[model samples]
Target: MSSTHNQEKLKELLTQYYLNTNEKMVFLNKKGQVIALNEAAEEVFSEDNDYSQMTHAICRRCEGYSNEFDLMSCENCFLEALEVGNGSFQVFMRTKDDKIEPFTASYEVIDKTKEIYAFTLHNVSPQIERQDRRYQRLMMQKTISAQENERKRISRELHDGIVQELINVDVELRLLKYQQDKDELIDNSKRIEGLMSRLIDDVRNLSVELRPSSLDDLGLDAAFRSYFKQFEKNYGMHIVYHTDFSSQRFDSEIETVIYRVVQEAMFNALKYAQVDTVYISLYQGEASIIAEVSDQGIGFKLGDKAKGTGLGLFGMNERAELVNGSVNIDSQVGRGTIVTLEVPITDKR
Candidate 1:
């Protein structure tokens, strides 16, 4: 059969199947115009019988979106599929009754010659709920994994660089106390003393990983600069940093969340992007603070399973949401990865 014929047959079959649905069903045109809906769908998206007035009401209520950016509707809007003429997706939606529900939706071009398209949403509340639970569990695991990785990194840095250097310094100082050929050995001892002092400073700097005093004492800008310096020094990755936030101290939780997210994103960039350079931008808007990290290197597939624990992205997202913020990652194979996080901020008054 012709593709056109097949589509019509499929639509009819879908309509018949959907008529028996206990959940909501909605159909939209390419312009987000509500064309058809089952009884459940009508009641969910509209309060009255005038379904035409509903338009993309359901799309507007979708919960998943890139908080880092301003979006008119959920990123999962069926119109996104309509744009391409053959994409389908599902997402959580908040109904007109203020109840959250899930729907399985698809959009396809019905008549390419006439530019007519159809978007269908089948009530998939059960499936969506199940998937959401799975997502949460995955996120929790990610957070735990990230914490462990951090501990290991700090431990190694201290053991290899700081602790070992201190040991050598201690031995040198002991020799200085024992062997003094008076004026002859004084300069050599002084030079060793200078090296030991610098080593002490380095160890002190390494301790910043445990808890950056700069975050509380100097605020985010200073803290980030210090952290980025250490990131470059230790990981050998260069970061292009930019900031435009008002020099105001945030709640401790917000500060820590932002710091950790940036830290994670940079690490991911270094590991996956294979690029030597990372870009970071921080700016505050009227109601939200935004952080963006981008890297130009070998990009991996989005939604693809991460080779390791896959907790890095998950942890970053959880931290963002902890502060009522949202995280978005945009990446494509061979293009690069961009992570943007936004958190709501209130005036201290």
Candidate 2:
């Protein structure tokens, strides 16, 4: 075959490959004229794409752009860097529908003398959205942890210091009642005793909410028993708590994370599941300590718009990760949701 015929055939083959590929591709001249566009690019940019106006139109609709980044079209503008043959990185672009979409784009300068550039647009919107959500979850988890730590500090102060002072005052009032003959003093002493009793209960409840003393004092088994009993009473949700973790002492952090994750999962069940029963189980399985919180409530669609801030599941996952654990949630529309967390047990002994 002649050299010119071979070149033409090679061009046809390359054209067929690109047209068949799923990604969108477009070629533009230095003066910003649309020289060629593949089928997908034609659909996205539209058949009647006004090259003159749409050339820089993308800059106006893109997100996370700043003048400091020199991002008029894309951050690096790979088409402009074709001379160096370095592919520019992830860039956000605007669709014809005015929606900002993410793309992993690259450009190759075909002819330096002619200034012709061929660009490829790989749709990465789904991946970018997933990454952004993961970041948001991490931030929310840190915020929740900080808030809980603050509450714990305050609860400890109230339980150890302020409540003790109140108790002392009540004791003094009783002593005064015994020393005085006035009926008014005796009545005041009774009122003070009642107030002190209520205050003590509040203190204990606050402390438990912050850091369950039972978990610290007794361990996960006893702590869970008290927690579930109270959960059933408060939420009217019957939780069938089962455990084969007899006398198992988990690392303090591991125990706390597991307990809190189960607690949140239960709360999610009550708030969204709408069922009356949640089954919880914990035991040593293989090299990990596994905790499962399953509820027979109305389930939810994963990755759908959450009823609330959507942080419940996110928080649970974060807590599990803190102890080298993993959380899995399974649910459908009518079926109940099951949240499972598995933490690798360390052989510290």
Winning model by TM-score: 1
Misplaced by over 4 Å in model 2 are: 1-188
Candidate 2's TM-score reads 0.55
TM-score of 1: 0.63
**Cα lDDT of model 1 by residue, 90-116, tens digit:** 555677778866556555776667555
lDDT of 2 by residue, 273-307 (tens): 88888999998887999999998778888878877
Enumerate residue pairs that collide in model 1.
none
User: Any idea what lDDT model 1 has?
Assistant: 0.74
Q: How far is candidate 2 from the true structure (C-alpha RMSD, Å)?
A: 14.7
Which ten-residue region of model 2 has the weakest summed lDDT? 60-69
